[model samples]
Target chain A: MELFFQFVSNTGFYLADYRNVIMIVVGSLFLYLGTAKHYEPLLLIPIGFGILVGNVPFFKGFGLGIYESNSVLHYLYFGVVTGLYPSIVFLGLGAMTDFSSLLARPVLMLLGAAAQMGIFFTLLGALALGFLPKEAGSIAIIGGADGPTSIFLTAKLAPHLIGPIAIAAYSYMALIPVIQPPIMRLLTTRKERLIRMPELREVSKKERVIFPAVGVLLCCFLAPASIPLLGMFFFGNFLKECGAADRLAQTARTAIIDTATILLGLTVGASTQGDVFLTGKSVCIFLLGAVAFSIATASGVIFAKIMNLVLKEKINPLLGAAGVSAVPGSAREVHLVGQSEDPENYLLMHAMACNSSGVIGSAICAGILWSFMVGL
Target chain B: MYGLQAITAHNGWAMAFAGALIVFSGLVVLSFIISQLHKVLLLFEKKPVDFQNDLERPDIEPPEDKLGLSLPKQFPADIREIARLYKPLVEALGETFCLSELYEILRKNDFPHPHITLTALRESEILIPDGDGVFTWNPPTENDDNEKVEG
Candidate 1:
C-alpha cells in the first residue's frame, strides 16, 4: 500500500509543471496544424511528436532528456549539434531541385538576393534586444525561412539557441500560406499582381550540367564558410544533372533526405524542453523571427516594384515575395495569390525562379553571418 | 529603457548595410556569369536546336508507335480508335486542348475512352499537361520526322 502510494505520487501528473503543460499543448497545436491543416506535415508531425516526448517530465538523472549524456535522443541529436543533418538535407534538396527556372531568367536572381534584407535587419534587432552577436546572428537567420540553414547557422554560432530558432524558422515556413498573402496583397496593386511575365527561354542540357560545377566554384569562392552546406548542395545537383549517376541522385533525394529529415525534425523538437524553451529570450526570438520574416517578404516584393521601373517588359512583382527560400511553398503561395487576382496569370514557374534563388541567397547570407559572428 | 538601450548598443545598421551589399554583389556576379553561359556555350559550337518552330509545324506527320505502326501502340486499342475517329477535331484544336473540350469532341463523334485516351496521350509523350486539365500536343522533332520518312 505504501509502495503503491509512492508510485502514484511519483507519476507525471504530480511531476509536471505549468510550463510543461504549456509546451505539451504547444506540441499538440503543432500536431494539429500538421495533420489537419496539412501545413508542412513532413516536418511538423515529427517535431510535434518530439515535443510531446520531450515534455513528459521524466526523471532528469535517468538519462532520458535529449540533452542527457549517453541517451539515445542525445545520440540522434548529435547530427543536429554537429550540423550534419542540415548539410545532408541540403544534398537531398540539391538532388531534387530543378534550377532551370533560375537559369532561364537570371535577372530574377536579384529578387532572391534582395529578399535577404530580413536576415541582416533582424541581426541588428537581435543585437539591440541584448543577444550576443553569435546569438543574434543565429536568431536573424530565421528570416531566411530555410529551416536547415537556420539550424546550420545556429549549430555553428549559438548551439544553445538552436531549439527555439529552429522551431521559429519552421513555424514561419509552415505558415507561409497564411503569413505571405497579406504582405503580398498589401505591397502590390491588383494590376501589379496581374502583370504577366514572358515565357522563360529554354536552358540547354550543357548549361544544366555546367551549373552545379560553376555554381559551387563561384559561391564557395565568395563565401568559403558556406562550402560545407553549399558543397553538398551542388554535389547533389551535379549527381542529378551529370546524367551519369541517376541512381545516386535518386537515392540522395528520396531515401537519404527522408531519413535525415526525420532525425533532424524529431531531435530539434525534442531539444525544446520546457526548461530550455519557455524563457523570455525564446519569446523575444520568436517575435524577432516574425519581424525578420515579414521584412524579408516585404523587401522582396518592394524591390521587384523598384526593378519594374528600369525594365522594358514588366515583371509580376508577386514573384519577388517568393525570394525568402521556403522553396516551392513560397512560390506556390505567390502563384495562388496571382491566380486569385487573375485566373489566367500562371506565375508559378517565374516564382519558382525567385524561390530557388532565395534558397541560394539565404545560404550565402548564413555563411556571411557565420564568418562574421563565429569568432567574435 | 533596457530594451531601447539594447537596440542602440550594436552597430547593426552598418552590419546590415554591409551584409546586404555582399549578398547583392555575390548574386549579381552569379547572374552575370549565368547570363553569359549560353553565349559562351554557343561560341564552343554546342548550340541547342531551336524547337519553337518545329513545335509549331502541324503539317509534320506524327511518329509511329513501338509496334512500327503510325499510331501509338502503348495506348489502349479503344483510345487508338478514338484518336483515329477524332483526328480532324484534334487538327482543328491546334497545339492545345482542354480535357472537357476533347471529351465533348469525342462524345459528339461517338468515340469511347476519352479519359483513357487523354492519359495514354500523356504517357506516350504526345500530350503534355499545361495545368488546369489542359494538354498541349508535343511537336514532332526533326529526328522524328527523319525517322518517319525513313520508315
Candidate 2:
C-alpha cells in the first residue's frame, strides 16, 4: 500500500499541475462559446480544442508532447506568423464583396474612410497609456474589428501581440450586434433613422468587370504594401465577376477559404497557450479593443451625418456605421436595425457598397501599418 | 513548494508572451491611426466635391426604373446561349406532372416568373388542371390522357 501510494504521488498522470487543469477548463469554455454560443465557431472551436490539446499535461506514455517547438501548432503558426494565410482569406473576401452600391454613390466612400478614425484615435490612446509604439499600433488595430487584416498587420509588425489582437478583433466583431446599436441611436434621431434611401439604379456588367481590375491597379500603385493581400483579393473578385471563370472562382471562394479557416483557427488557438496567455497586459489589450471598435463605429456614423448636412439628397447614417471590418454582416446589421424602424427602409445595397469598400479600405490600412513598421 | 510560488516560476514564459502580444497590437493601432489621419487631412486639401452634383449626374445611377428587377434581355440571352446547360434537368422535370414541379422547372431555367410559365402553357392549351394538386400537360391535338413513362 505504501508502494502504491508512492506510485500515485510520483506518477504525473492527470492534473499533475493545477494550472493545466485551469487551462483545460478555459479551453472548454472556448469550445462552449463556439458550439453553444455560436461565436465565430468555425475559428473558435478549432482554436478552443487546440488550446485544450496543447495544455494537456504529462502524456509522456504516448511518447508525445504538448505544444513543443516542432508541434502541430508551431507549423500552423508558421503560416499565421508569416502573414500568408490571412491574405488568402482576404482573396475569398474580395470575391464575396459587391462594390456597385459604393460606385453608385461614390460619396459614401468617405464613410469608409471616416470609419477608420477609430483605429487612429485608439492608437493615440494606447500610446498615451505608455505602451511601446509598435505594441500600441497592434492593440489599436482591434478598433477596425476586421480579424484577418488585424492579424496580417500584427503578424508583420508585432507578431507577439497576434493572439490578443485577433481575439479582440473577432470578439468585438461578434459583439457588433450588441455594441453598434446604442451608439447609432445616441447619435441619430428618429427622423434620420426613418430616412429611406431612394432606389439605386443597376450597374452595368461592363462596370462590374472593370471595377475590380481598376481598383486593384489604383490601390496597389498607391500603397504597395497592400498589393500581395489586396491584389489576390481583387483577382479572386475579378475572376468571379468576369463571368467566365465560374468553376475556379467558386472553388477559391468556398473550398480554399473553408480549408484555410480551419487550419488558421487551430493554429491561432494553439498559439494561445497558458504560458502565452493569462497576463495583465492581455486584459488591458482586450479593454482597449472594445474602445477602438466603439469609436470606429461612431466615427463612421458621424461622418455620414456630416455628409448629409453638406449634401441635398439623404443617406441613412446607419449604413455608415457598417464601415467597421465585419464586412456584409456589419452592414446587414445596420440594414436590419433600419428595417426594424421602417420596413420600407431598404438600405442593403447602399450598405453593401460601403461594406465592400471597407474590405479595400481596411487592407490598405493594414498595408499602411506594415509600411510604417518596415519604414518602406 | 506548491501553488503561487510554483505558478510564478512556471509562468515566466507566459509573462514574456503577453509582453510580446501587447507590443504587436500597439504597432498595428499606430499605423492605422497615422494613415487615416493622413487621408482626413488630404480631404481638406482637395476641393469639396459636391454630392448633389454627383447625384444629379447620369453617370452615377442607371435609369430609376431598373431597381430590384434585372434587365429583360440579360439572363435570357445567356440562358438560350447555354440552354444545353439545363437540358437534362428540363427533361427530368417534364416527367413530374405537378404545377409546383413545372414552376420549379421554369424558375431553374431563369424564366422571369413561375406564373408566367404556367400562363404560357395554359394559353397554348397545353396544361389542364386536373382538379387535384397535379397538372396534366397535353401535347396539342392529342386526345389520349396517357400516363406515358419515359426511361
Candidate 3:
C-alpha cells in the first residue's frame, strides 16, 4: 500500500503546483484559440503545449527531445535563433510573391516603410518601462506582424522574451480581421476607401526574375547583417518561381518548408518555459505589441493618403493597411474592404505586392536592429 | 547575491541600449539603398528602347490551344485558350493523345492516372516510342476500335 502511494506521488500525471496549473491553463487557451478560432494554429498550438510542458513542476526531466542538443527541432531552432529559418521562409515568400502591384504604383512601398514606425515607437515604449534594449526591440518587432521574423529576432536579441513576442505577433496577426478594420474605418473616409486604382500594367517574366535578385543584392549591400535571413528568403523564392526550377520550387514550398515548420513550431513552443515566460515584463510586451501593430496599420494608411496628394491617378488607401508583416491576412483584409466598397474592385493582387514588400521591409528593419546590436 | 544581480541587470540594459543604436543606423542605410534602387528602376522603366515597351503590348492574345502552360485551369475558355496556347506541345505529341486528351479526362473526372493511361497504351505495342523524356500518347488498338465499338 505504501509502495502504491509512493508510485502515485512520483508519477507526473497529477497537477501539483500553482505555476504548473497556470501554465497548463495558458496552454489550453492556446489550443482552444488555435482549434476553435483557427488563429495561427500551426505555431500557436505547439507553443501553447510547450508552455504547459515546460511548466510541469515534477516533469523537469521530460525534455520531449525539444531541448535535446541533437534533436531535429533543436537543430531547426538553431536557424531560428541564428535568424536563418524566418529569412528562408521569407525567400520562399519572395519566390511566391508578385511585386508588380507595388511596381505599378511605386508609392505603396513607401506605405510599407511607414508601417514599420510601429516597431520603433513600440521599442521606445518598451524601453521606457525599463526592459532591456534587446528585449524591447524583440517585443517591438511583433508590430511588424511577421511571425517567423518575430520568432527569429526574439530568439537572437531576447531569448527570454520569446513567449510574449511569439504569442503577441501571431495573436495580432490573427486579429487583423478584428483590429485593422476598425482603425482602417476610423482613419479613412468612405470615399478614400472606395477610391478606384487605375488598372495595373502587366509585369513581364524577365522583370519578375530580376526583382528578387536585385532586391536581395540591394538590401544585402545596404544591411549586411540582414543577408543570411533575407538572402535565403529571396533565394528560396527565386528558386521556386523562376519558371525553370519546378523541382526546386516544389521542394522549398512543400517538403523542406513543411518539415521546418513542424520542427520550428514545436521547438519554439518548448522555449516558452513558465519560469522564463510568466513575468510582468512578458505582459507588458504583449500590450506594447498591440500598440506597435495598430500603429503600423495606421501609419500605412496615413502614408497612402499623403501620397494621394502627389500622384495623378487615384490610389486606394485601404491597400496601405497591408503594409504589416501579416502578409496575405492584412492584404486580404484590404482587398475585402475594397471589394465591399465596389464589387468590381480586385485589390488582392495589388495588396499582395505591398504585403510582400512589407515582409522585406520588416526584415530590413530587423537587420538594421541587428547591425546596431553588433555595433556595426 | 545582490552584487551579482546588479551586474547581470546592468549588462542586460547596456546590451539593449547598444542594440537600439545599431537598428537605427541600419535603417538609415536601408532607406538610402531603397531610394537609390527606386530611382534606378524608374530610369529603367522610362527607357523606351528597353523591353519596357512590352508592358503596353495590346496585340497579345490568349493562346488558342494552351497545352503545357501553367495557367489557372478555372474556366472552359481558359482550357480552350490553354489548348490554343499549347499548340507546340500538341504538335510535338502528334501520334499520341495530347494535353487536350488530358484536359478532357481532367474535366470529366477532375482527376486521371496520366502515367497509367500512358503506360497501358504503350504496353499494346503499336505506337513508336520517341525515347526522349517527353511522354506522347500512342494508343495501340486504334484499328480495333470500330470492331470493339460494334461488338
Candidate 4:
C-alpha cells in the first residue's frame, strides 16, 4: 500500500495544477478547431498535441520539460532555438511558390508594403504598453502573419516569448478566414469588392528564371540581416525557376518543408508549459497580436482604396487584405469575399501576386526589426 | 515605464517610424526594380540596339515584342482529345476559375503536360481568356459533339 501511494504521488494527477488544466483545455480547443473546423490542420494538430504533451505535469529537475536542457524535446527544439526550422520552411515555401503572378503585376507589391505597416504600428503599441524593446519587436512580428518569420524573429529577439508569439502568429493565421471577412466588409463597399482586376500578362520563361536571382540581390543588399531567411528562400526559388534542378526543388517543397513544419509546430507547442505561458505578458502578447493582424488587413485594403483615387484602372480593395503573409489563406478569403460581391470577379491570381509580395514584405520587416533591435 | 514617455525613453518612436520607413522603402525599391526588370529583359532581348545601325536605318521597326502575346504560335492538333479530357474537370470548377486554378487541378490530377495543354487551349481558343486571369471554356464545337455522339 505504501509503495502504491508513493507511485500515485509521482503521477501527473497528483502534481497537476489549474494552469496545466487551462493550457490543456486551450490545446484541446486548438485540436478541435483544426480537425473539426479544418483550420490549418497540418499545423494546429501537431501544436495541439504538443500542448497536451507539454502540460501533462511532471516534477521539476527530472529533465522532463521542453525547457530542460537534457530532455529529448529540448534537443528537438534546438532547430527552433537556433532559427534553423523556419529558414528551412522558407526554403520549401520558395520551391512551391510561383512568382509569375507578382512579376506580371509589380505595383500590387505596394499593397504588401502597406500591409507591413501593422508590424511597426504594433511595435509602437507594445512599447507604450511597457514591453521591453526586444519583447516588443518579437510581439510585433505576430502582425506580419507569417508564422515562420514570427518564430525566426522571436527566437532571435526574445527567445523567452517564443511560445506565446508563435502560438499567436499561427492562431491568427488559422483564424484568418474568421477574422478578416468582417474587417474587409467594414472597410470596403460592394462596388470595391466587385471591382475586377486586369489580367496578369504572361511572364516569359527568362523573366521567370531571373526573378529569384534579382530578389536575393535587391532584398539582401538593402537589409543584410534578412540574408539568412531570404537567402534560403531565394535559393529554393532559384532551384525551381532555374530549370536545371527540378528534382532538388521537388524534394525541397515536399520532404524538407514537411519535416521542418512538423518539428516546428510540435516544439513550439511543447515549449508552452503552464507556468511559463500563463503569464500576464502572454495575454498582452495575444491582444497585441490580434490588433497587429487586424491593422495589417485594414492597411492593405485602405491603401488599395487610396490608390484607386490616383489610378484610372482600379484594383479590388479586397486584394489588400491578402497583403499579410498568411499566403493562400488570406488570399483565398479575399477571393471568396470578392466572389460573393460579384461572381465574375476572379481575384485569385491578383491576390496571389499581393500575397507573395507579403511574404517578401514581412521578411523585410522582420529583418528591419531585428537589425533595429540589435543596433538600439 | 508605460505610455508616450516609455516610447520616447526607449527611442521607440524613432525606431518604429524608421523601421516602417525602411520596410516601405525596401519593398518600393524592389517593386520598382521588378517593374522595370521585364522591360530591361525586353531591351536585352532586342537585336543589340545596334546604335550606329539604328542611326543609319531609322525607319526599321523594332520587334513586335510585348507582354501578353507570349502564347506559342503552334497549336497542338489533338484538341478534341485534350478537350474531352479537361472539359469535365473545368466544369468541376464551375463558371469562373482563373487559369492558375485549372493548372493546379490538372497538376493535382497527374494529367500529362499541364503547361503545354493550357497554352494550347489558349492558342486554339478552347479556353477563352477574359483579358484578366479569368477564363471560360467554350461550349463543345459541333465537330466535338458529333465525334462524341459517334463514339
Candidate 5:
C-alpha cells in the first residue's frame, strides 16, 4: 500500500501545479497555431511539442529535465548553448538568399540599418525597467526580429533568459502580419504607399561573386565579434555565387539548415520551463519585445520618408516596413499592404531588398551588443 | 531602476548612440560598395587586346569571369556566362525562340552540349517561357555585356 502511494506521488499528476498547467496550455496553443493557422509552422510545431515535453512534471536529479546535466535533451541543447545551431541556420539562410534584389537597389539597404534602432532603444528601455545590462541586452535584441540572432545573443549574454527572449522574438516574428500593417498604415500616407519603385537592374555574375568577399571583410572589420554569425552567412553566399561549389551550396541551404532549425526550435522551446519562465521579468520582456518591433517598424518607415526628401526616385515608404530581420514575413507584409492600397503595385522584390539588409543589420547589432557586454 | 538615471548610470545612452551610428555607417558604406559592384566589373570586362595580336585567331578561349582562368576544379560553365554568351544569338533569332532554333545555332557555333546548356539556361530562369513552345530572353542591361568584348 505504501509502495503504491509512493508511486502515485512520483507521477506527474501529484507533482503538477498551476504554473505547469499554464505552460502546457500555452504549448498546446502553439501547436494549434502551427497546425491550423500556419504561423511559422516549421518553427512553431517543434517548439510547441518541446514546450509540452519540458512542462511535464518530474522529480529533479533523475537526468530527465533539459536542465539536468546528464540528460539527452541537455546534450541536444548543447548546440543551442554553444551557439552552433543558429550559426548553421545563418549559413543556410545566406545560401538560400538571392542578394540580386538588394544589389539592384542598394539605397534600400539603409532602411534595414534604420530599423536596427529598435534594438538600441529597447536596450535603454530594458535597463530603465530594472533588468541588468546583460539581461537588458538580450531583451533588446528581440527588436532585431531575428530568431537565430536573438537565441545566439541571449545564449552569450544571459543564458538564463534564452527562453523568454527567444519566445518573445519568434512570437513577434510570427505576428508580423498582425503587428506591422496598422503601424505601416499609420506611418505612411496613401500616396506614399501607392508609389511604385523603379525596376531593378540586372546584377552581373562578377558583382554577385565579389559581394560576399567584400561584405564579410567590411562587416567583420567593424564588428569583429560578429565573425561567427556573419562569417558563416558570407561563406554560404560565396559558395552559391562562385559557380564552382553548387553541391556544397545545396547541402548548406537544405540539409544542414533544416537540421539546425529543428534542433534550435525544439531546444529553445524546451528551455522555457514554467517555474523559470513564469516571472515578472518574462512579462517585461514580452512587453519590451512588442515595443521593440513597433519602434523598428516606425523607424524604417520614417527613414524612407526622410530619404524621399532628397532623392528624385521616391521609394515606396512601405518597403521600409520590411527592414526588420523577419525575412519573408516582414517583406510579405509590406507587399500585402502595398497591394491593398494600389492593386498594381508590386513591392515584394523591393521589400525583400530591405529584408535582406535587415538580416545583415540585425547581425551587426548583435555583434555590437556582445562587444559592449564583453568590454564591461 | 527607472528613467534617465538607470539608462545613464550603466552608460546605456552611450552604447545605444554608438551602436546605432556604427550599424547605420556600416550599411551606408556597404550600399555604396554594392552600387559600385557592377561598375567595377565593367573595368574587367574590357578586353585584353595587347596579347591577342593574331587577327585570324579563333578566339575559342572562354572569357575571363574576373576570377582568373585557373580554377581549383573544373566546374560546369556559369549560368550567367552561358546566358551572356548565347544572348546575342537568341536576340538575332528575333524576340521569341523555339528550343530547336537555339540548339541549331549553338550546334553551328560548335558549342559543346548545346542541349544540356539550354536546359541549364531554362532552369536558371535566364530563359523564360513565352507559351506556344517558345521562350523570351530576360531584359538586357548594361551588365549584359558580361562575356562580350571588342577586339
Candidate 6:
C-alpha cells in the first residue's frame, strides 16, 4: 500500500509544474499550427513533437533531459551546438536552388543586398536593448529570416541563445505569409504593385555552369568567414549545374537534407526546456525578431522603389519584399500579393531572383558580423 | 572613425552601418562578376538555331514514305507490345516528329512510361532517327497489317 502511494506521488500528473504544463500547451499549439494550418509542417511537426517529448516531467538526476550529458537527445543536439547541421542544410538548399533568375537579372540582386539592412539595424536595436555584442549579433540574424543561418551564427557567437533565436527565426519564417503582405501593401501604391517586368533574358548553360565557381571565389575572397556556409552551398550548386554528378546532387537535396532537417528540428525543439525557454529574455527576443523581420521586408520593398527611379524598366516593387531569405516562401507570398493586384501578372520568377539573392546577401551579412564580432 | 573595433565593442549604430556597407559591396562585386562573366561567355556561344523555324522550313526534303516497313523479326515481346500501342499515335503524328513533341502527345493521352515506349518503338525499327533527335515513323506494310486483321 505504501509503495502504491509512492508510485502515485511520483507520477508525472503529480510532479508537473505550471511551466511544464505551459510548455506542453505551447508545443500543442505548434502541432496544431503545423498540422491544421500547414505552416512549415516539415519543420513544425518534428519540432512540436520534440517539445512535447522534452517537456514530460522526469527526475533531475536521471540522464533523460536533452541537456543532460549522457542522454540520446543531447547527443543528437551536438550538431546544433557545433553549427554542423546549418552548413549541411545550406549544402542541400544549394543543390535544390536555381540561380538562373538572379543571374538573368543581376540588378535585382541588389534588392537582396538592401534587404539585409534589417540584420544590421536589428543588431543596433539588440545592442541598444542591452544585449552583449555576440548575443546581439546572433539575435540580429533572426532578421535574415533564414533559420539555419540564425542557428549557425547563434551557435558560434552565443551558444546559450541558440534555442530562443532558432525558435524565433523559424516561427517568423512560418509566419511570413501573415507578416509580409500588410507591409508590402502599405509600402507600395497599386500602380507600383501592378508594374509588369519584361521577361528575364535567358541565361546560357555556360553561365549557369560558371556561376558557382565565380561566386565562391568572389564571396570567399571578400569575407573568408563565410567560407564554411557559402563554400558548401556553391559546392552543392556545382554538383547540380556541372551536369556530371546528378546522382550526388539528387542525394544531397533529398535524402541528406531530409535526415539533417529531422535531426536539427527535433534537437532544436528539445533544447527548449521549460527552464531555458520561459524567460523574460526569450519574450524580448521574440519581440525583437518580429521587428527585425518587418524591417527587412520593408527595406527590400523601399529599396526596390528607390531602384525604379534609376532604371529604364520599372520593377514591380512587391518583388522586393521577397528579399528576406525565407526562400521560396517569401517569394510565393510576393507572387500572391502581385496576383491579387493583377491576375495576369506572374512575379514568381522575379521574386525568386530577389529571394535567391537574399540568401547569398544574408550569408554574407552573417560572415561580416562573425568576422567583426567573433573574429572569424 | 567607426570600424571593426566599434563593432567588437558593441557600438550598435557603427556595426549597423558597417555591416550594411560590407553586405552591399560584396554582393555588388558578385553582381559585377556574374554580369561580366555572362557577357564574356555569350561571346563564345554560337547563335542558337531556332528549331521551331527549322521544322517549318519549306526547303528541307520530306522523308521517303515508309509504309512497307515491318518490325524487326527478333524484337522483344515488351518492345512489340509497346510498338503496337504507339503505332496508331505515331501514324497520326504523320511522317516526321520531334521526340519531345511525341513525348508530350503521349503524356496528354495518359500513356504510361513515354520514354520506355519511345525506346521500345525505336528498338522495334518503327521509329527511324532523323537528324537532330527527330524521328520518322516507318509504318508496317499493308501485307503485315492485313495479316494482323485476318489472324
Q: Write the per-residue lDDT of candidate 4 for residues A283-315, one digit (tens) a residue.
A: 999999999999999999999999999988889
RMSD of each: 10.3, 13.5, 11.6, 8.2, 10.4, 11.3
Task: State candidate 5's DockQ.
Answer: 0.35
A141: Cα error in model 3, Å:
1.2
TM-score of 4: 0.83
**Individual DockQ of the candidates?**
0.33, 0.03, 0.05, 0.39, 0.35, 0.26
Against the hidden reference, what TM-scores do the models get? 0.82, 0.69, 0.71, 0.83, 0.83, 0.80
For residues B103-133, could you state the per-residue lDDT of candidate 2 as single tens digits?
6655544555345335655665556677677
* lDDT score for residue A333 of model 1: 99
Candidate 5 residues A29-91, lDDT tens each?
A: 989989999998988888888899999999998999899999999999999888899899999
Interface RMSD of 3: 9.4
Question: What are the Cα lDDT values of the candidates?
Answer: 0.87, 0.69, 0.68, 0.89, 0.89, 0.86
Per-residue alpha-carbon lDDT of model 6 for B1-151, expressed as tens digits? 2344444566666678888998999888888888787767756553443555566666867764433434455433444456666777677777898889888777665565455557767776778999898899875566666777799
Candidate 4: residue A102 lDDT (0-100): 93
Question: Candidate 3's residue-wise lDDT over A252-366, tens digit each?
Answer: 7776776666655666666665666677877888788889999989988887888789888768888779888687889899988888877646677678767877887788778
Docking class of 5: acceptable
> What C-alpha lDDT does candidate 4 achieve relative to the native structure?
0.89
Which candidate has the highest lDDT of all? 4
Error of 6 at A2 (Å): 3.3
Q: Which portions of model 2 miss their true places by more than 4 Å? A: A1-26, A58-67, B1-151
Off by over 4 Å in 6: B1-9, B45-151
